[model samples]
Target chain A: MGKYLSFSIIAIKHGYKNKGETIARFAFYGIILLVFSSLWNAVGSEKIGLKPRDMIWYLAMTEWIVLSYPLIHTAIQEDIRTGNVAYLLTRPIPYIWVKFFEGMGTLLLRMLILAFAGFGFAYFITGGLPTNPLGLLLYFPVGIFASMVVTLYQSIIGLFSFWLQDATPIYWIFSKCNFILGGMMLPLDIYPEWLQKIAMLTPFSSFLYLPVKACLELDASLLLEALIKLTVWAVIGLIAMQLIYLRGVKKLNVNGG
Target chain B: MNLKNNYEFFTHLLKINLKSLTSLRGAFLLQATFMIINNLVFFTMWWVFFKKFKSIKGWEITDLCALYGVVAFVFGVSVIFFGGVRSLAKMIDGGDLDVYLTQPKNTLFYASSSQSHASGWGDVVSGIILLWFSGYLTFGSLPLMLTVLFCSFVVFVCIGILFNSLAFWMGPMDSLARQFYDFVVTFSIYPQVIFSQFLKMILFTVIPGGFIGHLPVSLLREFSWSNLGFLVVGSAGFFILSVVVFNRGLKKYESGNRFIGVGTN
Candidate 1:
């Protein structure tokens, strides 16, 4: 655990070193918020139950989780593809946890940076913040846990490289699932009841919808429920990763040295 | 090379790319099929949106479908045929241009067309299906669709090259190039009616997202020779600009002697 904490600290430092990429990401994040806010405003926020301000804030929260997602899957894929996983397995620490901690480190930095930048952009675009300040405060832990689950899922996809020729397509489908069922763009409240029910059944909602919902309104019961569900999903994800990693390593084939 | 020779070489390059792509038949099929499914899943959000609101700013669900169709089709064509366009920045930064430079052909086209992304086929197929279902594709409009698709494809290629070429002036800025690429694609999928006039101006000019997404969809929605003419002129201008930019940047090229895949397979 101490080593993992060290890994996260090191990753945060590494993220700080990459200032240019971070700046570019923030620029893109701002642009996307601007575009989506314009669309919502054009649609007339009154038509929907929510205000344009809330929607902008919701999008900011969701996009923060998504944009901050470290491509740990790609790293894992490359490691497996280039036969570096064999060398990695020789290390004292578990490779999967190390990658997850590194991702958490990067995700923490991104979430922190984007939290400030996203808030500024959303506030500028919508001219206000979410009405519930406590909910806004709660978003940090919820968002981090949500992103950690996403990291685990990404690792699971990367581990599939043991059997599949490429795991990118799998990642694509997972991301789109996050977009649709996870309610990345619009809140699931507006979705049809049937779709919302289906979304709840999947772990996708725990990724974005639940976290952003915390910011929409302050409800202690709802936040507690969301945390429980997210915790459940995280446990499931970790179990799945362990199973996949164990099976995958058994079938590993190295091409060069 | 003359026009005819260039055409023949490009066709040959595409054939070789396709052959290599198909060599891994299972992976190719899986990637393409997954992408088609992935795109459809993405559309579900819009589908839900339209289900509730019906339409926004005179843009119906069908119009959005057509918009996505055109954008997907053009994107697929560009990436599948000119896969290297996306990686041009990395190639430039890694000094991977030596292979293209040593080739006895148009270096730009050769560099851009050396690889194929299998997922593009999924996009192409899904795009065609979306257009058909959206009622935007009919025998009378096939010619217009093809023309607009060609123009959109040209703009997409030009954007990739122009941004990737920035590596010449600034060293190894692939992430920045990728951001621009994503910005255009992100801006292109939304209805143009949603943008403010200021943003619209930026869309049509600085980022040129409008060329790849809006103008083409507008022409398809309501046919007009003037709009078509404008698209043609715009695409041509961009094409010329991309060529000039790439050539100017080539002068600053330094070889890192990196080991890059040269399409030998």
Candidate 2:
């Protein structure tokens, strides 16, 4: 656990050093919020049961989770592809936990930046803060847990590199699921009842929509539900990662062996 | 190289890329399939949006479909043929341009087309499907659709090169280039009516999202010589600007510093 904490600290330092990527991410985040704000503004807040400002803020929070998600899968893919996993396995700590903590560290830093920037920009665009300040406060922990679950899923995707030539396509599908089904751009209540039901059944909404919805509605019960679902998903993701890693390492036929 | 030679070389490069991708049939299929699903998933958002609101500022679901069809197809064309555009930043930053500088062929053309994206095949298929079902595409309008698609493709490629060339001036601009490129993509899918005049100007000029996203859709809806001219001129202007920017950047490019290769496998 201490080693994991150290990995997290190292990642934060590394992220600080590589501020260029953060700026780029900020620019993209700003652009997405700006564009979507315009869309919602044009759509107007009628019959949707949420104000345009709320929708924009919702998007900002969701995008924060997505934008802050560290691409640990890419690193894992590279390690497996180049057979560097062989060297890493000999380390005292497990690779999956190391990656999780590192991703959490990176996400922590990125989430903070994107949170301040996103909220400020969304405020500027929508001309007001979220109606519920307490929900905004609750966003901190919920957002972090959401991102942690995302990191575990990314680790599972990365572990697949042992068998697959390229795991990016799988990552792409997962990402789109988070975007569309997870309600990144809009609220799930706006979706068809059937679609909303399906999205709720999956863990996608737990990471994106439900948490933001909880923030928008200022409901602690909703927040609790979001956290509970996120924990369930994270546990499932961890188990999958462990099983996949063990099986994949068995197939690890590095060169010169 | 001459025009004919450049055309022949590009075709040959494309063929080699296709053959290489098909050689790994499983990976290629998986990638293409995933990309198709990705597009559908994104489109579902709009589908759900329109289902609730009916339309946005007079733009119906079909109009959105038409807009997305062109955007997706053009994006697919750019990545499929000019896959180098995606990695131009890394190549410039890493000085991987050394290999291309020694070649007898046109550096930009060869570098851009040397690789291909198998996932773009999915986009191509989905674009056709969307356009076919949009109720706007007909035999009579097919010629115009093709023209719009070509112009949109040019805009996509030009935007890619224009952003990528920044790496030559500001070292290692992969993220910046990608984000800037996303600016165009993110703006292009929405209704043109959503933006104000000032934002529209930025989309038309700075980001050039209008050339691919707005102008083409409007022209398809109501044919106007001025709008069509704008699309053509915008594409041509960007092409010229991209070539000039890339050439200027090439002059500043330092060689052989890149430790690793930067393009597709």
Candidate 3:
């Protein structure tokens, strides 16, 4: 509908107006990563074998991935906490679609500001970026698609609020577990072998670590397979998400706050 | 000037914070979860590095765990007692100082002690587990009695106070300041074994990152009476400095004098 399209545009405009926040968030990430990069580089430099540049490049990719964190977590949590979620049900637009799109709009701004800036700034700092420019360029779209996979996951988590008094405890346990399994703080390779193998099969790493690995690693024999697996996960996640929205709407006190 | 009044005031503050926090169990737990997730992530990094290097700059994974226990224990204690450390910028900017000032207790005491975090208990528990695990894994659990534990807790509170004081003047965007504090934590997460001498200096004295986790690492490596003394003096000094700065800032504060909590009319 025309209203839906216009609403999304307004959200983007409102979100991007805080340009200083975007810059500050990037700088925040930069300060943390720079210190971390230097430490890792020094650790690597007392070399068993790995190069400082490898640490630099790995951190650079992780920086961008972290900046492009999926928005579904914040979006769902905000709606549940503020109880403004009731506002969406009476409107002409679909509640799930509007929230999903609004989250995407904010996420788009993050990608442009943090991810794009990180890639550029990282290159300047380390003297080289991702080895495959074309593959990396292709990563942008795949990254967007992967975030939606996570949006579905978040929606499922948020849906529990409708039935439970408070979902935060549950959310915490799950998110913390996901953090280690998803490579939010460090790469999946860092986990013990059993955990690493387990993390690979799950969709959490698909959301953050895989794409970073795809673009950052110069080896291309596995790139096509990575994209294909991502596409498959995207389809499965979106379907489950739509089902959750439908079921969640049936339980809402749509006319009440 | 009266001991009884001060004791009564502190008790009353503790009761209020306990009542507010116990009712909202989930929210309080969520805060601690974030802290725990942060620490666990760092641990994972050390696990990976130790796997390959075996002994990084003469520091093993257990040494890293020892470092973790100090930072975690200190950070956990601060969140429990000095809850206002995170609330400084918002309280100042939003003019919420009016309520605390009008209340018949010390404003700084009220701010720091009047809050509770249930989730912080998780970090405290995790800190214990990590400490227990780290010691058992490393040196078969030596004699670290009550005195050392008390001094370590003091050191944590001092670091937190020092960092929070920086927010008094940083205005509304104190997240940048908080990140810098986290930056200190991140830098200190790794073993100091591989650090350049210059980096070690920056950690030990400049940013005081070494004082946080690195000192505990050294203590774990070689416990001495001197380290205990350092913690006592360092923590006391940091706390004194924080209180001094806070009182000085109060002379310059401009209150917003309005409620900014959820659904404030």
Candidate 4:
């Protein structure tokens, strides 16, 4: 635990040395959320009659998906390109656990920082704040579970680099596919009935929407459904990741150090 | 007599570069993947935007797709053909110019061409798909569509050179170029209508983002002489400026500088 924690923290510290680019990325995302939040707030009031409190709920709930989602791309790309996977393999800790936890650690810090920034930006723009204390209570666990779903999905794709030489193109395909299914771009609830049915079969929605729904509506029946869905997807993700890891390691004679 | 030799030298240089990348499969494949990913991301961004607004500033899915398609196709071609532009600073800094300069070729031509980005090649495919989709929706004549695509090709070269010449003055340019690419890409995903007057001017004259997709796209939407004029002039000006800047930077290069090497600089 100590070793993996230190590894994850040190990676962040090393990465922070070149803080300008990352700061810009965080700011870029912040700008997108701000622009959309302001637009949606006005549109919601004018068109859909959603209240300010509901706006805040949307903002807070989507935070995990927006911030941590990019990390899914970055973590996978970096680990493969830098050959850091080999370093993790050298560690005494089980490679999968180390990767899983280290990813959690890095993403946790990124999500917290970006979420706070997104919240501040959303608040100033919309003058909206979460209405319910229970939404606040459920937010943390939902965030953790959502992030886990993202990390696992991303790492599985990243590890494919061992076989394919470069995984970004494929990752792009899957990640965009995730945007539709995961409800990262738009809520599954809003999708057409057919699309919604298809979306449910995929685990992407479990990554972003389930958490957001839990936080925003405080919909108890929906929460129960989300929990079940999350558990099932998490298990499937674990199985898939295991198969990917085994295949990737066997094919790991890639030329670059 | 020397001029004749210089022409021969450039031909030989092109032949060599063509040979080099032909054998480098891994890098090419990786580059192709990166380009495809970029295309997918924009597809998502636009899909969601179109979903939310029903329309953004009088634009539809077809319009956005056209803009994205042109940008993607143009940018992909630029990257594939001018890949070395992204590496200009590092190549200059690391004294790698020794390799290019010693060959009896125009250093600029040799440097710019045969820098194929594999990922961009993949993007080219997706770009074609989007372009075809948009054209099928809006364009009535196939020949006219082909003519505009050719203009878009010119925009590709012009904007690429304009952006690449920045490696002359910028530091650690890989990231700078990346930021530039990101900025161009993000804004390009939307209709140009929402841009303020000042920004619209910047896009038209300075950055030539207008020509990159907007002008030709407008033509596709509604044939207009003014839009074509904007496209032609903007592309010509930026293309000229970038070449001049690159030549100016080339003169300042100290080909064998050791300080810019790993240990010293």
- Measured by TM-score, the strongest candidate is 1
By DockQ: ranked, best first: 2, 1, 3, 4
The DockQ value obtained for model 4 is 0.25
**lDDT for each residue of candidate 2 in B18-39, tens digit (9 for 90 to 100):** 9999999999999899888888
Report lDDT (Cα) of residue B77, candidate 4: 69
Ranking by TM-score: 1, 2, 3, 4
- lDDT by residue for model 3 (A125-209), tens: 6787545556567667766666656655665666666655355555665565556667765667655789888888877677667
CA shift at A4, candidate 1, in angstroms? Answer: 2.0
Per-residue lDDT tens digits for candidate 2, residues A1-257, read 78799999999999999878888888888888888878877888656887787778888899989999998889888887787877998898887788878888998999889888888888899899887867788888888889888888988888888888589998998999999889988788888888889999988889899888887788878988988899999889878988998887777754335
Model 1 lDDT at residue A252: 76
Worst lDDT 10-window in candidate 3 chain A: A45-54
Q: What is the lDDT of residue A114 in candidate 4?
A: 67
Candidate 1 chain A, poorest ten consecutive residues by summed lDDT: A248-257
Between which residue pairs do clashes occur in model 4? A182-A204, B31-B118, B31-B119, B32-B118, B32-B119, B33-B119
Interface root mean square deviation of every model, in Å? 1.1, 1.1, 4.4, 4.2
User: Candidate 4, which segments miss by more than 4 Å at Cα?
Assistant: A34-64, A67-88, A94-102, A127-141, A253-257, B1-57, B89-98, B101-108, B136-170, B195-208, B248-265
What is the TM-score (0 to 1) of candidate 1? 0.97
lDDT of 1 by residue, B53-136 (tens): 878799998998999999898889888999999999999998988988987888899999988899999999989988888898
lDDT, each prediction? 0.88, 0.87, 0.65, 0.66
TM-score of each model, in listed order: 0.97, 0.96, 0.83, 0.79
lDDT of 1 at A245: 88
What would the per-residue lDDT of candidate 4 be over residues A155-241, giving only the tens digit for each residue? 777777776656666676676667677777456666667778877888877777776776677888877888888888888889999
Q: What share of the true interface contacts does each candidate keep?
A: 0.74, 0.80, 0.26, 0.17
